[model samples]
Target: MIARIWHGRTRVDDFERYSDFLIERAIPDYKNTEGFIKLVFLRKKTEKEAHFTLITFWKDIDAIKKFAGEDYEKAKYYEEDRKFLLEFEENVEHYDVFAEEYA
Candidate 1:
């Protein structure tokens, strides 16, 4: 398995709206792609910013390529993100999953 991670931030006040966009738009888009195993979104809020990290599991690199294309390390963005993001991250990180445990 492969695990892909992406991070972004929004103004603290816009946090809930950004979260809703991910649930209503981003998650569903991921579900429609081949080899998409699972995804988890984590959030942290402070007085100034709301940070988000998206962790996605896939069958392999090919699976990620289906979503990210030839430059698979590049981060993917939705049109709506431009309005909320404090800055755009150009790339994402990926790792080979060595083991797993479920609670």
Candidate 2:
């Protein structure tokens, strides 16, 4: 399995809106992607901002390419993101999943 991780942050005031966008829009798009396996969405809030992390599992590199294009390490974004995100992060991280368990 291949794991792709993306992280972003929004000001505390925009947190809820951004979160809603992720759930209502981003997640569904991921579900429709070919070879997409699972998603782990995480959030952390501070007095100033909220951090969001999206970890997506894929069957292989090609699977990620279907979503990320030829530059698989680069981050993907929607036009909606600019309204909430603090800055544009240019890249994402990927890892080779050697082990996992679901219960």
Candidate 3:
């Protein structure tokens, strides 16, 4: 398995709006993509900004490539994101899922 991690930030006041954007827009797009097993969105708020991290699980690199296209490493962004995010991150991180646990 593989995990794709993306990080973004927005003004503290826009946290709810940003979360809505993720749930309403991003999640649906991800769900329709090939090889997307699941996605977990994490958030942290500070006085200045709210940070978000999307941990997306895929079956393998091929699955990710299918979802993200040939240049999969190039981070993709949605137009709706511009409304809430303070800055567009230049890169996203990916990790190998070496272990797991379910409850």
Better of 1 and 2 by lDDT: 1
- TM for every model, in the order presented, reads 0.98, 0.96, 0.93
lDDT of each: 0.96, 0.94, 0.89
lDDT of 3 by residue, 1-103 (tens): 8999999999999999899889998898889888889999999999899999999999888888877777777677988888888888877889999999999
Cα distance off (Å), candidate 2, residue 84: 0.2
Expressed as tens digits, the lDDT of each residue in 2-72 for candidate 2 is 99999999998887889899999999988999999999999989998899999999999999999989999
Worst ten in a row by lDDT for model 3: 66-75
Candidate rank order under TM-score: 1, 2, 3
lDDT of 2: 0.94
- lDDT-based ranking: 1, 2, 3
Q: Which candidate do you rate higher for TM-score, 1 or 2?
A: 1
Candidate 1: give the clashing pairs: none
